[model samples]
Target: MLKIKLSIFFCFLLSFCFAQRELALKYETRLHTYLTFKGSLSPFIKITETDARVYKSNQDKLNDNPEFIIAYDEIKTFEQLVKNAPNDSIEAILKRKGKTKWSKKTKSEIQILYENEDRDASENKPLSGKRILIDPGHIAGNFEMSVIEQKYLRFVKDSVPNLPVDSIHISEGILTFATAQILKKQLEEQGALVWLTRDDNKTSFGITYQKWLSTRKQIVLDSLLECGAMEKTKYNKLKKEDEKTFFWSFFRDHELANRVKVINKHKPDLTIIIHYNVDEKNTDWLRPTDKNFCMAFVPGGMNVDALKGINGKANVLRLLLTDDFPLSEKISDLTVKEFSKQLENQVAKKTDADYLKDNCISSSKQGVFCRNLALCRLVKSPLVYGECLYQDNKNEYLELSKADKTYYGINTNTRVKAVSDAYFNAIMQFYKK
Candidate 1:
């Protein structure tokens, strides 16, 4: 009885001390402490190495600053950071300049932001003043320009079995960019501020495939040497190694990192990733089969590689601090609904787990699911990654392949317009309430 009382007292003391030092605590220590609550940690607070961050998820309410980020140089192991923090209590910390502004707001207003339940949908110009970022998946271009979304292109052959692989026809990069362009124009027309991650079919990384391979070798060597990891004399030997290492490790990975940086910089209220799905049954994209589907992704599918480096740690922190997942899921549900409605009951049903490895998670809606896709997981905003329609469906293939018709500066089939319209309507419906 005495020991139980002592334990309870000790836990209370620890909690009090933590609350006092929370503001000044190191990122890792604070995250660890915050994650101690069993109920609070469920469905969130993941610590995976998906993008290379120390901590992976966050929980920020309206008017609440995300995490108190210490300078990189000041960041230390949990013990080291907490050891030297001043003995200011939580109340005292709130009194400090530029600190705990959340306390200044009305409790009711804060509650409103937290719940955000009674927020009304706008009738006209619903998206006005909203900042939106559009990321078109893949690095694609005209047939002669060389395709860079190698992952998706390869999947085309592997998705369908026993199909003779021929010349690449449909490119996810090109199609997505085209879709993004249309969406951007429509959103802007609705009074929303919009931006695209990439301007053209090539890449947002500032280099094409030809130039990336040719010039990246020396650049990688210079980076290694500049970071004091390589000696001048060893440049020749390391250059050969870096040639292969740079492409996958730095080049490909860094491209995604760069995109994340820009998206965070813009601080969009929402991020919409445009992608076209493919039928796993139809590998031969030249002749599309009847299989089709529509789905969208929110965050939460984190795996081992999520917390790999500094950006990965930052990504995890951003995800943890922001209260965006619920909203992301809501918008994705709306998008799936709007797309299904637009497709006239042609939406893909829940896929079979035996064939589709990424089976749909249980949700209020049919097609929408939380996936751990890179853009879906990394972007620090309400994100909806829409796999609008299946490009491998025979009807969709013909519709998508109708490139002779021109709309909004790119030659696209009427189907592309329909896809874009579905997205526009979904966004409008989501925001208009």
Candidate 2:
């Protein structure tokens, strides 16, 4: 009897060890396949059976030393560490582990439990108590602002044969904001709490570009320089650059960071980033193009150069350890499917755009690609960065220019409304699953 009991105990231990090894293999496979853009093993990250180590560079790995070490079971604690010490180096955060407010709770802690409970209780309201965040890409409010941001579709009268409009001067930002507003309303009507990152004609900073320049520009530049995100030479050049250069450079990335900050703080169950696509080959967007395609981006696609910073490395680890990657893929897949079906646009193939081949990792899903976009990497929630219909496409431009509808006092076209409906349907399907 004693021998039999000992045999059972040893077998249990062995099986547990096997399970752990299998899980580690699974994670490593995911890391290489989905996260690494080049489909090669990253030099900065080393994974073992029990823990993953983040190295500052290949030299650190050669020394067999890591900057930060996170055990498999301590993923939740590591998450808290990063949040509490967003500016601190990963090594510093790990060193002061016990000093920080660490929690042993799982990733899907109180908030998710409450969301599930609310979801269970509200059968009639499919999205009841769910939180959704809508990020309208870009800060341009009008044609002039759009021109400054270089995100507008422009064409003179008769630029394209049989063009419906006398001229086309549509701002991508305006379209995104309109689409986000419509989607927010639709989600809210379905009993979800929705938040937009910015107001109409405004930026994620809660102000217009002009206002930000007048009030916060110097302060932001100083902070960027101090943080080493901007070099001193670049900071000096920015002071002399025109407003357009400023918007294109520092303001752009900082605003995106602001969006990420707010979205992470909101802790939304899902995030939707809205943008109108344009033909990458359409230089200057001076005229319409025959190309129209739909695509969606999720996290991953991190190259070697992308892992230069502590924050970027931390985010990569977060994505690898958490369910964000798979969930993002699912929702993005659904979104692209709906966009193709509703808009009568084809899902973009890897061959459709050069960037799609060179800069992204194509997913198994038809139109979903894993691109290392700013919001894609930093936003903590499962998100879909949607590039709907191409704004520079000939027919799409005419259709999107029609001011046939208005929602909440915002003027938008039927095409934009259709895009909103596509997103709404996708969200509904996501929740149904």
TM-score of each: 0.64, 0.87
In order, what lDDT does every prediction score? 0.59, 0.82
lDDT tens digits by residue: candidate 1, 1-433 = 9999999999999886676455334333334432222233333333222111222244332333323332322222211212212223211321231212233243333333333122222535667778889988766665444233343333244444543443236666777878888889999887888988876755565667557667775786798889998788776655565434544544566678678767766767788988888766555444556666787877754554664543443445445444465678788888888888887536445453222345333344567665566677767678888988877665665456557777778788777787788888888877874
Q: RMSD for each model, in Å, please?
A: 11.4, 4.0
* TM-score of candidate 2 relative to the true fold: 0.87
Candidate 2 overall Cα lDDT vs. reference? 0.82
Question: Considering every candidate listed, which one attains the maximal lDDT?
Answer: 2
lDDT of 2 by residue, 25-111 (tens): 978887888899775447778788887887887898888678676787777656554543445544455554422333555333422
lDDT (C-alpha) at residue 95 in model 2: 51
Question: What range of 10 consecutive residues in model 1 has the weakest lDDT sum?
Answer: 77-86
For model 2, the stretches where C-alpha displacement exceeds 4 angstroms are: 2-7, 39-41, 80-93, 97-124, 222-233, 305-310
> Which residue pairs of candidate 2 clash?
none
For model 2 the local lDDT of residue 30 reads 76
